[model samples]
Target chain A: MNHLLLLLPLLMPLYGAIFSLFFWRNVELQKVFALQSQVATLVSCILLFMAVEDKGILTTQVGNWPAPYGISLVADMFSCIILLAGSVTGFAVFMFSLQGLDFPRQAYGYYPLMLFLQLGVSGACLAGDLFNMFVWFEVLLICCFVLITLGGSRPQLEGSIKYVTINFLASSFLLAGIGIMYGLVGTLNLAEMALLVRILEGHESLITMAGMFFLVALGVKAAVFPLFFWLPASYHTPPIAISAFLAGLVTKVGVYALVRLFTLIFVLDTELTQLLLSVIAGLTMFIGVVGAAAQTDFRKILSFHIVSQIGYMIMGLAFFTPYAIAGLIFFMVHNILVKTNLFLISGVVARHYNSFALKDLGGVYLKQPFLALLFAISAFSLAGIPPLSGFWGKYMLAKAGLELKAYALVGVSLLVSLLTLFSMTKIWNEVFWKKKPDETEVALLSPITNRMLHMPVVMLVLFILFISLYAEPLVHLAYRAAIQLLDSDIYIRAVLYQ
Target chain B: MRTIILSIAIRLLIPLFLFFSLYILFRGHNHPGGGFIGGLIGSIGFIFHAMVHGPQHTVNTFFRINFYGYQHQPTQSRSIYLMRMMRVNRWRKRKRHYLERRNRNRGLLHIEPIDLIAAGLFVATTSGMLGLFLQEPFMTARWVSFYLPFLGRLGTPLLFDTGVYLLVMGIVLKITFVMAEE
Candidate 1:
């Protein structure tokens, strides 16, 4: 039964991709298949949550292969929370993609690629082996390459070349790191690696080098500070729906992988790695929000914020405590929903105003009051204002940081939160609250395009509200996840000895 | 007079290069020389042939005529050998027709050997890349047994080399195709 739960999310997407490919020309069939797969994945995730509520950790060997020799897929608290969050955002993105565009016929390829990508993400979250994680990352990366270049326009091509090149380099580093780790430990399994590291606790240099390689590789993927230039340059060129989905989920996956691996496999050198991570995290938040403040393009600003928000998640890990890690999980879940919704709302604003540049977009409230309200709510949630999902995540993280006596990081995080609010207000004042532009500006806008766009925005808005209202159950789930993550013995025993 | 001299030079150099490439392909398992280098050499051979005889004449000699007795079975491991031979025959015919048309229209002065070389380079590079993947799971060595001309085991190194050769040849042909359109 536990194995079935682990396999269901992945199988749904794989089956969906196969079914959609056979009916490529039938858009309605494709949409139905995509939606059904997402719903199935979400339902399966809920069931997995229930089963693991008290069990603590579940391990299943994929393909019925025994542990160590066969690939193992393990879901402790951390991965399960991420999988649930990923499914929610993935479902919203699928709905948005269905309704959003005058997508060309060639885009029949998109649904299959999207499903394949989800399969990769699910596999990545559940994978207990390092090489298996790399394989899943490659699968997702290849699909992203196809999706980003789907339209094959000049901008898409240019952006994709950079995207592919940078990511390819990152992949090589990941492969090299895995090779080195394997050479050193003689095992690729995460649980096995963790046990080995603990046994050889004083081998500081080898562990640090491995950790650094991972940091660089995952940093590029996560768009963490200093490696974030590609995010703003390339993310905006994809179609708005694709951009939203990507903006919502992709980087967070990297952060999830980083948290899982560092917490489980490399905890021995925590003092050294966590200090370096804390410094980087502080800079990541500072630099990200500053970049956001400097941007005039709506998507570009949001893209910058992704970099900044990753800082918060890294900070949770840097604190190296269960409560902080729990806060990170909660924060990641909130951010994915809120960010995707905000980007989708930007899509709507672009539809009404003819541009994502602040100079051209104005008075959204005058035209669409409800849209403005929804945007404001999401923006504030992102800013970590009280009574929202974001606030709880920030509160717990700050509390954890203070407990750890990492006062400077706590201060930086607080300041970054305020700056985040300031930028959100700037966007609100420029795009939503300002007076409507003159007749000439109104004439420049496209005709009221696709009312269907509102469906995704509504779905995401309700998701955010649901999390805010039912914070207790989710917070408790996060606490359990955090506990499971810190307790390495459970993971090692399950995957290695089960 | 200049064209004849160029043709003679290419004729002298092409076969030696092709022989060296074959040597590399066969010995790749224990050494660095593999399918990629060998395929590149093969592409160079075709390119030199085009340069010396002129593309039209080369196409007529190599590609234009149908080569009888060539049968391709989709499931057969040795199908690639048949495909290569057919491709060579087609090239010969095309060369022959091209030379005839050029003689009638432009008196041979309009043909360019550099175009042929560029076309060859393109084919060689692409085919080499494709050839690299013919071996399954990539970078893993395997021994394949065949029953043709009695029985023998061929290593993946040879298969990879053949893939490289084909890739190079295909790329060169494609480049020429594009250039001709331009």
Candidate 2:
């Protein structure tokens, strides 16, 4: 029964995707069925989280195979946390797709594809072995390829080609990394490798070589510094709902992998890795914000900011303090919700104005103040304003940084936050506060679309508020998860000796 | 494209190819042959038939679902408007001749490749869940108490292999026909 609980999140979405294919004739039924599956997944996510909270950590060695040999599905606090946030945002994005996405794309297996994407995500999150996680990422990538090019517009085709090429490169890097790690460690299982890394004693350099392979591969996925060029170029080309989904969760999976490995398997030489990661984090922040400042498009700016916010999470991981790691987890969840909401809001802006360019968008403040307020809450949260979720995350990290006495890196983060605010304000001034453009026609939104677009954003806003207002429980949870991560024995024991 | 000798030869060879594919599919699990190779062989049989007779004719005989895809919208004006768009190359004009042939040949049974994919996924998932019903973890193989006369030790793994077979066959045929249509 316990193992079943862990499997529900993956199974629900997989079943949903399969069944949605059966209902290809009726798009409306497909929509309802997909929503039902997502709801089931969300329920399962809650159950899994509760179970993890109660039982400490849940691992099922698949088929009763001995540890390190068979596929294992494990859910620790961190994965459950990521799963919870992902399901909520996934549910909202599914709702938004009903109205936000155009009809033809919906008919072209969009709902099923979305469900498959969810399966990939939960699979990646829950997987206990490195190779299994890589397989899940491939599943996730295939869905993205089709979703990105569903319309087959010229831009969509061009963007998807770029997206595919870069991701394939990343996947190869990851596979090679996995091969090397397996060769060096003789095991692909996380817990087993953690134990082996401690025992091997002499091959620290080769291990770090494998770690470098992962860093570059996951760097591309996470859209870090030099490797992030594909993101802004392609992310803005997809439909807003798809963009929001990808922007919100996909890159973060890369970060999740980094945290998992660096803290667990790649800890052989933390001194050098820490310095290297902090520098990368700092440069990623600076370069991302600088790029966002240059973009005048609504979704484009948000895409660039995705890269920037990731740097903050990476910084949190680099510090390796319990508080910093806790902040990293907290910040990851906070960023997912806030970033997805902002993109959905951008979709609303694009729908009404028919343009993403800042100059052509305006008068939402005067015309649709409700939309403006929804936009304000999320955008402001993203900018790390006080009393919002982003602020708490930043506060935790900065406090951790201060405790570490990393003053220069701390100063760099604070400056990056300020520049983030500048970019958000730029969007605010141009998209909402300015007068409506004189020349372009404004598209009217039907009541259903109006409801569909705002419902998800509003739900996410409530979530952001919930997190900010009721901070202690989640904070405690993240703190405990952080402790669990740093003390790797608990995980190894749960998987190997349980 | 059809030649009388090739068409007659395909008429005799296709059934043999299909029979060998099923034999190969059943031979999977303990041996090397399995769903993927079996499906490839099955698709090869059809491909040969398609090359000799016609793709439309081959599709109509086996599948009981629509294979004609979403309508290709006439983009006469839009294509011109798109700066990057170019006219369909004349070298690909043979694609149109097949399209015209597709309209003329109507089969009573026609299955879309996507339908096969969906059905295959469903079957594979169901087979995995069967282990769950038996109180085993997902994708764990569950065999019957008694063996079948030919396919010995009927099990969820075999069901899973069948699903993969259909899935692979569907994928290859879909790509082949769609490309052949265009």
Candidate 3:
């Protein structure tokens, strides 16, 4: 029963993709089926989360094979919560896509590709071994390739080619790292590999080299400072629905992988590595918001903000404490919700204004006060205003940093929050408060599309509000996940049954 | 642009290529040849046919389905292979031409590439669900070892393989046909 729960989240989307592809020509059927399957995926992940919460870290070996010999699907608290976040965002994005994805793209297999991407994500989260994680990452990258290139527009193609090229390089590095690690440790199962790395006598420096390789690979995916060029270039070019989905979920998966491997597999040379990561985290945070501050386009700004927020999550991991890890978890989940919602709302605004450039967008506040309100709620939450989800996350991380006497990083975090708020206000002023452009025409969405768009945004906002108001459960969950992450012995035992 | 020898070679090789693809598909259950490669081989046959005769001729030769109904009628004038396969005598040339023209106008077969995809996916999913019904994880390898009269022992994995084979073939054909048209 437990194994099936772990498999269900991945399989539901796989089957959904296959089934939706089978009915490729029937766009309406595909839409309905895709949404239904996403909901089903959400339900299954919730069930899996419950199971994980009740039973500490569940591991299921595929084909009844013993762990360390065959592929295994394991769910600890961290992976399960992330999976839950993936499913929720997936559901909201599919709902948004129904109205947001235009007809030609829908006909061109968007739904199937989205489901495949979700499958890759869930699989990546649940994978119990190193090679399997790499495979899942490839699957995830391939789906992104197709989704980004679906329209065949020149910009889409240009962006996706860059996206694919960089990601392929990252994948090669990841593969090389896995190869070196396997050579050094003699096993690919993460649990067994951890044990082997600890006991293996020689080649300590070589293992550290492999660990650096993994960091660089994941760093590219997570859009950290120097490696983040591909994200802002590519993210804004895709359609709003695709952009929203990818913005919310994809890079975060990379961060999740980084946190997992760093916490569990690469525990050697902790102080030095943590120092290196802390520096990167600070740079990532500062550079991302600085880039965002310079952006005029709404989605482009959000894309850069994603990079900045990733810095915060990495900062939590770099602190190398249980409180910090828990804060990272809380911050990651919160960012997924708020970031995707912000992008979705931007899409809605674009739908009305007929432009993503902030210079051309205005009078939204006068025309639709409710839309303005929705934007403020999510935008403020993202900027770490108090009593919101982002504030709680930032608070926890800042508290942890202060306790560790990382005064520099804590100050950097505070400065980034202020810059983030400045950018959000800039957007608010330019896009909403400014007078309408005289020549530009603002179109109203069809009642159905309006309803569809509004539902997901409202639901996500309510969810964030709920997380803010009643954050105790989420904080507790994060704490437990953090403990499990810091004490890798629990993970090893759960997977290896030792 | 038709070369008589080239056309004849294509006509003769079509059956051989198709047979080879089937062989590859069947062998995929145990050996390395499986759905993806078999589908590629089959698509190579159609691609050759398209190159030799022209995309329009290939489209007329193959049938397709859209959301509504059959996309093309498989008949003598439209289907070049069907026209050549007929055994009309010289004495009945005029009447044969009329009949062939009429056959061209008639809908002899209504098959579409999408049907293969839909059927293949359905079958593959069903085979996977069989494991689920048996209270095993999805796509679990379960075999029935009983020998049949002619086909021998069959396993669920083979069923899954066949489904993939059909789906890949359908997809290849669909993509090749669309690309060949323009």
- What TM-score between 0 and 1 does chain B of candidate 2 receive? 0.71
Better model by lDDT: candidate 1 vs candidate 3: 3
Give me the displacement of residue A163 in model 2, in angstroms.
1.4
Best by DockQ: 2
Candidate with top lDDT is: 2
Off by over 4 Å in 2: B65-110
Q: Which consecutive 10 residues in model 2 chain A have the weakest lDDT in total?
A: A60-69
True contacts kept of 3: 0.19
What's the TM for model 3?
Answer: 0.90
For candidate 1, what TM-score does chain B get against the true chain B? 0.48
Model 3 error, position B52 (Å): 2.4
Clashing pairs for predicted structure model 3, backbone only: none
Assess chain B of each prediction and give its TM-score: 0.48, 0.71, 0.65
| Candidate 3 C-alpha error for residue A30, in Å | 0.7
Q: Write the per-residue lDDT of candidate 2 for residues A1-498, one digit (tens) a residue.
A: 666887899999998888888777679889888989999999999999999999898988766577788888989999999999999999999989989999999998999999999999999999999999999999998988988888988888888888899999999999999999989988989999999989997899989999999999999989898888888879989899898999999999889989988998999889989998999999899898999999999988999999999999999999999999999999999999999999999998888888899998888899889988988888888989988888989999999999999898889899999999999999999988999777577787788878878899899999999998888888999999999999899989998897
- Writing each residue's lDDT as its tens digit, candidate 3 over A377-495 gives 99999999989999999999999999999999999999999999999999999999999776666786789879998888998998899898899999999999999999999999999
Candidate 1: list runs displaced more than 4 Å.
A105-108, A440-451, B1-182
Give me candidate 2's TM-score against the actual structure. Answer: 0.92
Candidate 3, residue A296: the lDDT equals 97
Kept native contacts, as fractions per model, are: 0.00, 0.49, 0.19
